[model samples]
Target: MAKVIVYPPTSMILYDLVERMGHKALVVSEAVRNLVTASGIESPPLNVTPEEPKKGLRYAAVDVPSGVRGRMALIGPIIEEAEAAIIVEDPGWLTGCSGCSRTNELVRLLIRTKGIPVLDLSYPTNDDEAKVFVQKIRTFLEGLK
Candidate 1:
């Protein structure tokens, strides 16, 4: 099965679709869920881990800003592991985009460099578009399998 990386990092529709098509979606939502479940307390540490370097580094081991490091760590590994991609860029929804521009750019770069099959799509603005979105993604993923 191909490993499909879905952008927005939290699109449940893409996650479900990937699984339904017998593929895996590398996403951060599962990380969030694990954090919450493991915390068991009212609050949890936000993305801080013992392994988190005091500074951030690029995939090449070149040092970068800590902010960029934090964002990269969220999905860099997934990008490398991905066998394919389903990018749903919905610029109209302010909150639907990545956390910042740097992360967004890096994600696109990682995906592009991999030279894998990809299904690039935009976020649907209406119910009709939503339906089309699902169908499009389904077809793309099934074709991969």
Candidate 2:
């Protein structure tokens, strides 16, 4: 099965669709799961490990904002492992807020440069648009080997 990275990284709809199509959906929750469930975690106060910031440097420079670095650290590796991607642009705040615009842009850039097949879609505003959106996503996913 293809490893499909969904833009926004937190959209369950995209996650579900990818999984439903028999591919693995790479989303932020998986990273969060690793952070929280790891045995070395000390407390619930912080979500990040000391190594995260350092790992992030591979994707972003030290001078960049720590937030971007932290996010990239968690997401960059996922992007590297992606075989394809599905990006839903300008999704409503509730649907696609990754909370950092820089991170979002960087993530998209990384995915696009990965040389994988990418399906870009706009957020649907109406029932007809929504149906088309789903169809496009389904078609693109099914086309993957």
Candidate 3:
């Protein structure tokens, strides 16, 4: 099984697709889950400190425009440990797209340097494209090993 990282910090489709194909989808929500569960307070809010950014550590304080360093604090650790990646983006997706272009570019650059197979896709607009997209993704994952 491969550890594939899905970007946008929140893409259920990519995450689910990875898991359904017998791969692990390492997403930010997992970190959020850890933070929430670590407090031992199964509640809506998590008690996390937003300290200075540090490499290989989770940074609760997420600042979009704080440059790549700040944004990396939120995702660098996950990228560092990822075996593969599936990055999907769509200009129409307001919420799923990166808020900062520079930060997005930095994330893509980091993914490229992971020396792993990456499936970069554009969100499908039609049913035909959707099918083809999924097929490509499945092919990419199967070829990973």
All predictions: root-mean-square deviation over Cα?
A: 3.3, 1.2, 4.1
Task: For each candidate, give its TM-score against the true structure.
Answer: 0.78, 0.95, 0.77
Model 3: per-residue Cα lDDT over 11-64, one tens digit each: 677888889999888876776666667745554454334332443234223454
Candidate 2 lDDT tens digits, 1-145? 8999999898888999999999999998898888888887775644686677788999999998888888888899899999999999998777756789999999999999999999999999999999999999999999999
lDDT of 1 by residue, 81-140 (tens): 888998877644442455667767778878878999978898788899989988998889
Worst 10 residues of 3 by lDDT: 52-61
Q: How many clashes (backbone N, Cα, C below 3 Å) per candidate?
A: 0, 0, 0
Model 1 residue-pair collision total: 0
Q: How many backbone clashes does candidate 3 have?
A: 0
Between candidates 2 and 3, the one scoring higher on lDDT is 2
Screening candidate 1 with a backbone cut-off below 3 angstroms (N, C-alpha, C), the clashing residue pairs are none
What overall lDDT goes with each candidate model? 0.72, 0.90, 0.70
Strongest candidate by TM-score? 2
Sorting all predicted structures by TM-score, with the top scorer first, yields: 2, 1, 3
